[model samples]
Every structure is written in C-alpha cells, then in structure tokens.
Target chain A: MVFRELSLPVRLLFYLFLIVAAVSILYPLTWMSYTSLKTNEEVMLSPFGLPTRVSFENIAEAWQTGNFTRLYANSLLIAIVSVVGIITISTTAAYGLARYHFNGNRALFLYFLVGMAVPTQALMVPSFKLMAILDSWAAALHLPVPLLNSPLAVILTYMSWSSLAIIFIRAYFMSIPPELEDAARVDGARELQILRHVMVPLAMPAIATMTIFYFVFFWNDFLWPLIYLHKHTLRTIPLGIMHFEGKYVSLWSLQVAALSLAAWPPIFIYVLFHRRIQRGLTEGALKF
Target chain B: MANTSQAGAAIPRMRPSRFRLPPGEAWRENLYGYLFISPWILGFVMFLAGPLLVSLGLMFTEYAGFKKITYVGLANFEELIKFDIRFIGSLRVSAVFAFWTVSLAIIISLAMALLLNQRFKGHTFFRGLFYLPAAVSGVAMTFVWAAMFEKDYGMFNQILRIFDFDRVAWLTSIEWALPSYIIMRLYGVGHYMVIMLAGLQSIPDDLHEAAKVDGANALALFRHVTLPLLSPTIFFLMIVGMIGSLQVFTEGFMLTQGGPARSTLFYVLYLYIVAFTERRFGYASVLAWLLFLIIMGLTLLQFWLARRWVHYESEEA
Candidate 1:
C-alpha cells in the first residue's frame, strides 16, 4: 500500500523512525560544537552536559597550537591544484572518448574504467618506491622540490587518480546530443573552441559534482599524506588533526575544537550544495 | 567492440561527402583521440599499471628498503599461508569486521530508505540531515566518535555512569575494540541509504498500485514487489560495502591504532604497519596482492550469487 494509505499508527511510526535517524546523524555534530566551547573541568564534571559559557578560548588555543592555519592552507592548495589538474585532464579525455570515432576508442574507455576497481591501498608499497625513483630523477634534473616528502608527491598522486572523473564526465558528455557539437563544427569552429563554448557550459552540473566529489576525496585523504608528507610544514588538515589528537591527549576541549575546525569545510560544503551532493552519490552508484 | 564499430559506421552515413575526404581524415581523428587520452594513459601506466607489475614481482623477492634484494621464490606466500600468525589474525579481523559492518549497513540503510521512501512532510530535510554525517571528513568523524567512546569522561561512559554502570573501555579492551570500530564505521552509512532511496524511487508506482488492486496487504506488496525490485541495489551495496569495509584504515588507525591487543588490526592497517613501520616492502607487497585477490574473489562471488536473486527489468519476459 502507498504510504498515504497506511494506518495512522503506522504513519506515526515511520515519522518517529525518521526523526530518530535524523537525530542520530546530527546530534554528534551539535554535541561536538557545544563541547568545544566548554572548559576542561566542565567537560570532566559533566561530559554529556552543554557548555556553561560560550567560550572562544579552546578554539583559539587549538587553532594556534594545532597549527591549523598552515594546515588549512596546505590542504586547500593541494586539493585545489589537484582538482584543477584532474578536471582539465579528465574532461579533455572524456570529450574525446565520448565524441570520437577512432580505432580503439572503446578499448581506451574500458582501460580507464578498469582502473576504478583497483584500490589505492594496494599500490602503497610500489607507489612509495615509484616516488623514491621519481625523487632521484627530479634531483638529477635539478628540479626545485624532491618528490619524496614534498607536497608534490601527494598532489601528483591525487591528480593521477582520476579514472572515476573521466568515467563520470564521459557519461555526461555522451548524454549531450551530438548535434550541438556538429552544429559548432559546421560553423568552422575548432574542436577546442566547441568544447570550451558549447560543451562546458552545458556540462557544468556534472563538473560541479566532480568538484565536490574530488575536493572532498583529496581533502579527507589520510594514507597517502601519511606516507608521502612526513614534513610537518607540509601536513594537510587530516594529518594535522590526527597529530592534534595525539598532542592534546588529555585536553578534551582543545581536541574537540581542533576536530570542529577540521569538520567545517565539508559541513559547509554539504550545507551549501547538499542537494547536488546527495543526487550525485546516487547517480554515480546507480549509473555504475 | 562490435557496437562501437557500428556507431563509428553511422558517422560515414551521416556525412555523405566524408568518403571523398583524404585518408588523412581518419589519421587525424586517431591522432586527436590519442592526444586527448595521452595524459590518462601516462598516469595509468606510471601510477597504476607500473606499480602493479612491480608489486607482482616484489611479491616473490625479499627486497627491503634500498637494501640488497634476494630472490625468495614462494617463500613469502609460504610464510603467509603457513607460519605468519599476525597475517592470519589480520585476515580474521578484517573478515569479522567486514561481515558485521556490511550486514548491518545493508539492514540499517535499507530500513532507512524504506522509511524515507514514504511520502511525508519534511522528508527532504530529513534526508539531508541523515546524510550530513557521510559528508563529514573521515578523520573528523573518527575524532568525534573517539570522544563519544572515551572511557572516563566520554559521552557514552558519562551516560552509563548516570545509571551507575561501570565505564567500558571502548577503544582499549580487546573484546570491545573491534565492535567499537564497527559502530563508528556504521555512522557513515547515510550515503548507502541515499543510494537505496534512489533505487526505491525508480520502481514504478504502478507495480505497487497493481499489487494493491489485487487485494494485497502492505506486507505482501513489499514482499512480492519491493523486495525483488530492490535486490539489485542491495546487491550493489553489499559488494561495495564489503570491499570498503575490508580496507578500513582511518578509524582503526586514529581511534584504536589496532591496539590494546591488536583486536582491531584491520588488514590495511596491518599492511601499513608492515610496509612502512617495519620496512618490509616485499612482504607487504604480498599482503597487498592477497587483499586485492580477496576483494576480487568476494566481488566475483557476489556477482555470481546475484544472478539467482537480483532482478533486472531488462531480464523480464
């Protein structure tokens, strides 16, 4: 039976269940924020209790001591650079795959699609070795930064892992009618111009999804940074927050505040474009 | 390949004068395609395929970091299969964690999808609210759970103390650590729920209406129509969830560090320890390949099982 046709009690039960689900998801976040404002003594006395006063003391302390400003800058730089590179590479490749009639086009598309199933975890050892090898090569060529412990290592890793982006944008491009591109071609427009003018504006929605998806992916990435970025000055948000917890083992308020800072970007992004993010999740999964 | 060739054949018919063009047209098209995809091909080779081949070779040889390498044919596999207690323990830990987490995620997320699928006011708000956790960064999410599961002053213990129960060591005790890890991982299943909700929406309303018109009750309608239709989504979630669960690292690394007694030594965490901390790159390569094969096997097995239960509309008579 349709939900509207259900008995009153059944409908009420569904509402109750949904309410509980929402609370379970949201309460931890609210609890975290409020607890960050509490004093350590207050937290010890009543761990589950609300803050007595709205205090900026803990957040301020954590920000300075945890080195969050530097971490945020590093994280933002890496995620932004990697995302720009990924989009540029994937969209150009996806357009070609979607619209071209070349030999082995199908083979090339499948080749990328297969990379999606290979987990990054499985490549850790060899990736480390590869980075070491690249470091020597860079040093021989007298490049500025070594690939071993620099941010470049993680950024390059992030950029290289764009199979999903290629696949997603290719599907979106394929959905666009070929007639639009044909029309542009008939006007004597070059392929790049048509891609820039005709295809991109129409593909903004899919691009937006990819931006959110990869931005969050690179931002929250832990293992690669944990491996490649050993220098404290180059630490990203996830690495910084992790070491924050280790440093402030006994200071609950500071730890909570640091975590709250780390959570803000993703939460802010979610609050802003949650509708697209949610739809994107389903579209990626269902379409795959 | 045949379908793609057919599509390619359609291009010539669309442009009648294309046959009069020089042979360089096809060559130019091929060059353009190759140019566009060259970056991906370079990345795939250097980052993925090259590493894969190197790791495959390393799986047999005894190669430590920059140290002289020795050819130890079949020895790593023999040790892992026979004498490595820690490796076996890690496999068991990963299996138990995957089993419980995937099963619970499917049940909880499916129930959530079913609940929100019904028409109700504020359903959209609730969907966003429920999914908000999945959007939180993993490290941030882990810290929040760490605070909640803290022993002396954490939220769970504080609430338990209100009822005068003793504080349980959530991340410390051996028996409790894995369960705590599972609980923390389950907090991020909101994305899975959204996927299931999408699946539910795709099922035609006419099917439900037709079932009701046949004098079916709510349970019968759900049983006969909803279950079959949603099986494919469930199957998808099951395989994806299991694969992710088997490779879980952040929570274990952050919250427990696979400690108190290695009760939470997830497979990936152990691999990290072996590869990085212990500097046994060759041995870790063996572990990495094993994990990959395990995931591949489970995925293939799930796909094989799905043929019996997963109902696709295209397969219907």
Candidate 2:
C-alpha cells in the first residue's frame, strides 16, 4: 500500500508499462476517430496525421449514404422493447423464485441455468425454421400479425437469449433480507403491490445494471439481425455497417466514419457508466 | 413481498397448517412456476431443443436442407475422420487459436488486474478505455480493424515502415492472418481484467500481511497467497474462453473468409459454411455434435485437473 518505498527504477518501469498498455488499448479508437474526419486524399497521403481540414462531410455522407439514421432508429427500438420485456418478465419470475418456496423450484432454477450454456448458434437453424413456420401459421389463420423480418423478430430472439440476466437478478434478489418482505406482508400489501413498491425499489441498482447490459447486447447484436431481418429497412447498426461496406467498395473515409458512428453509442455509455458495469459484471460473475 | 403472506395464508386454508404443502397446492405452485417460465421454456423447446434433436437426427442422413434426407448412417462422421482434408486442418487451426488466445488472454488480464488492484491515478478512466471494446459491436470494430490492417495504406504497415520492414499482408497471407485476428480480438481484454480485479479485491489483505511478516517477497507471496485463491476465477475464465474461442466466427467471417489456403478456416466457420452455404445440414449436425462432445470432454478434463491444483480456502484442503 505504501508506494513511497518503491525504488525509482521500478517505479519508472511500472509507469512505462502503464503507458504502453494504455496506448495499445486506446490508439485504435483514436486512429479510427482521426481517419473518420479526414478526406480520402488526406487519409491516403498521411494515415496518421491530423486532418488538414476538420470536416463533418464524411459524417454527413456516412449518415445519408449508409442509411445510418434508419439503422440507429431500428437499433434503438429493438433494444428498448427487448429490455422492457426482459426486465418485466424476468423480474416477476425472479421474484417468485426468490420469495416463494414452491415445489420444483430448484429443478426449475436449474432448467433456466442450463439455458445459459446453450449457445445461440446451436439454436439458430431451428429458430429460423420456427420463425418461418409462425409466419405461415399466422397467414393461414388470417391473423394480421407482422412477425418475420420485423422488429418483433429481433425482439423475441433477444428475449430468448436474455435468460442469463434473469438468473443474475434472481440471485441478487435471493441475497436480500427476508425481514423487509415480512414487514410488507404484515401491512396486508398484495403480492403485486409489494413487488412494485418494495422489491423493485430495493433492486433498482441491479435493474439499472441489467438495463445497460441488455441495451448494449441488443444494440451490438449482428447474427440475429443478419439472419432474421432480411429487409434493409429493418437492419441494425452492425448489419447496416456491413451493408455499407458491401455497397461502397473504396469509400474508406466514409466507411470509417460510419463504423465510428455505429460503435459510438455503446462506447459512450460504457465510459459514462463504467463503474456500474464493472460492479454489475463482477457481482454476477463472482457470486453466481 | 406481500405475496409471501398470501402464499402463507393460502397454504393453510387450502390444507392443514403444516410446513409442507398439500398435493393440490404443490401442483398449483408447480403450475405457477411453469407459467412464469413459459416463454423461455416454450422458446427453448420449440426453437432450441427441437432443432438440436433434428440436427442430431440429421447426422445420420444426407439431408441438404431442401432434399430428402437420405439415411447415410455414419458416412459423414466417417468422412470427417478419415477422408476430409479440411476437417482435421480446421480442427488443428481452431485448437491452436483457442489455446494461444485463452492462455495469453488470461496472462495479460491477470497482469492488468494486479496492476489495477494497486491504487493509481486515472485508474477508472483507464479501466473504462480498456473495457470499451466489450461494449462496442464486434462487427463494427472488425471493420475498423480491417482498415487498420490494410496492407497498402494501413496504420500498422506505416508503423512497420518506421523500422524499415516491408508491409505485411495481415489479412491476406495465410501465415499472418490468424495471428492478426488473435491480436484484433485481444483488444477486448478489459472485460476479463475487470473480472479478475474483482476476484483480486475479494482476497483478504490480512493474508498478504501475514505472508509479508514471514519475510515472503512479492513473487513468493503472490505464488503462495494470490494464485491459490484466484484459481477458481482463472478456471472459470479458461472454460468460458475456450468455448468462446472454439466458436469464433465473426472475425474469420468478416476479415478472412477462411482464406489464404484455409489457414484461418476456424471450425465453427467451416461448420457454418457446410450447414448454410453448401446446404449440407446433415454434415453440419454431425460437426455440431462433435464440437459439443469435444467441449464437454474438455470441460470435464479441466474439472478433473482442478481437483489437483485449484485450492479453495473455504473448502477442506
């Protein structure tokens, strides 16, 4: 704990190591940001130099040419809807598991835990087929439901993979003292009322953490969108970036701008809420 | 919270006032639990389990997604074992990638965690900067990394030119491509570092103090005190890391397309090509099962080895 005791050479070495690690980690992002602002000629002539002209033209071009505005909106809608659904459904389920000692409770908990290890890739082919079947079934029944290639498909897929969040929340819930619930029960509060008023308030930190994690995952997801959302209009930012690359072959500046834009939201969120993310992930990983 | 009282009251009214529930109440509670988990369960059975079974069954056939699934018995497995040239090659490449990446990742992250455990200036900012990659979309970062590794005008080549070295074909050459992907992937060390730091923080300072009083130097103290306690975290990282690395797809798919003589053709990418592009659903299923078995076996082996090396202070040594 006493850093003053360390020798000068050792301290210098430690500082040098820290500098190298920081540069290695941050340089790519810095480079990307720099290149995004530069013109094509500038990028070709001096890859590492400051942009001679700091123009938002590449940003403007990437936004319009890559349909990034639409992609951003689509990604936002999917992430918000999915997080809402996951938090509501999983909180209720975790409440039941944490508060009630029912038959098959342990077995049911294990069943959900098993889903954690079931790789999404393993389920992709089947999920695809099921979506197709649902589309046909809805059509046959004359049910005016828009499911496939819609935001709904992406949301549902996201929900299926979000059981890990539920388990983490439930474990945290279990650690809460039973005295609070007993007091609520003595006040003749209904189960739903207790959940809404007491448990939810107490678990706000965990719930906030889950929301951020789920948002990042949903926002960054590529494979599910690639497989399910065939329409260009429904593509998320990740898929949109890929499509941009495919359409514009040599537009490196615009592509870098688009890539930076697509990657910025999550990076910004991480920077702002870095402590919460660390706490959440550490608590979940270590305890559970 | 109020549900506890309702449950408590409903239990006695429906049956005798005992700790255990009556048969009917038990059934009702079970039904409620099932109802609560219905969405995930239904999704699992319909989307995950059903397809998994179908894929398993398909392993014995020649189903190509569109054609009749002609029963081929063990022919796909047979070919994979004895005949397919790329099959074993991809496995070797995947094994090498998984082994090196996981080992290096563990070493680097643990080092970072140790450093971060010491109080430092701008520690939080550094932590955030490192972990930013975890939140960033892999596909988008890969795009940025692709440009960074571009042979002609890439920043990496420009740096190499400082040393008078020729430009390297990072993504095009079979020799350097896989290593490049590994390096690109290594930038996400922030996630692992945070986890390891958590584990390190949980260690009691008293233990280190005791070791120091016994004249133990830093290396000896770390060896005797730190690593033994950190083994469980290390073990968790190894298993998850290996499983993740084996299923590597995005980087290979985006950057290399498993090219340059298929040196970068990872096992999962090869299986994806077989299943989707070639329409060889049956063969793909066989490959999937093989992967499942290998992963399960390796995990079991890790657990077995952990019995010898992984020390838990809470458990009897």
Q: Top TM-score: which candidate number?
A: 1
Candidate 1 Cα errors over 4 Å, as ranges: A5-13, B1-24, B162-166, B297-317
lDDT tens readout by residue for model 2, A72-139: 99999999999998888778777777655566666777666655666666656556666777877998
lDDT of each: 0.83, 0.77
Candidate 1 lDDT by residue in tens digits, A161-214:
888899788878877777787777666777778889999889899999999999
- How well is each residue in B130-180 modelled by candidate 1, as lDDT tens digits? 888888858988989987897776778887899999899988899888899
DockQ of each: 0.55, 0.42
lDDT of 2 by residue, B1-317 (tens): 12222556443121111245555556655555555566656655665667677777878888765536699989998998889888888898899898888889999999998887777667777777677776674788888888889898787898899999999999999889989988877778778888888888889999999999999999998999999999878887888788878978878887787998999999988887887788787788888878867776665655556566555332242
Q: Model 2 chain B — which ten-residue stretch has the worst lDDT? A: B9-18
What docking grade does candidate 2 earn?
acceptable
How far out, in Å, is residue B317 in model 1?
20
Q: Which stretches of candidate 2 lie over 4 Å from their true place?
A: B1-19, B22-28, B67-69, B295-317
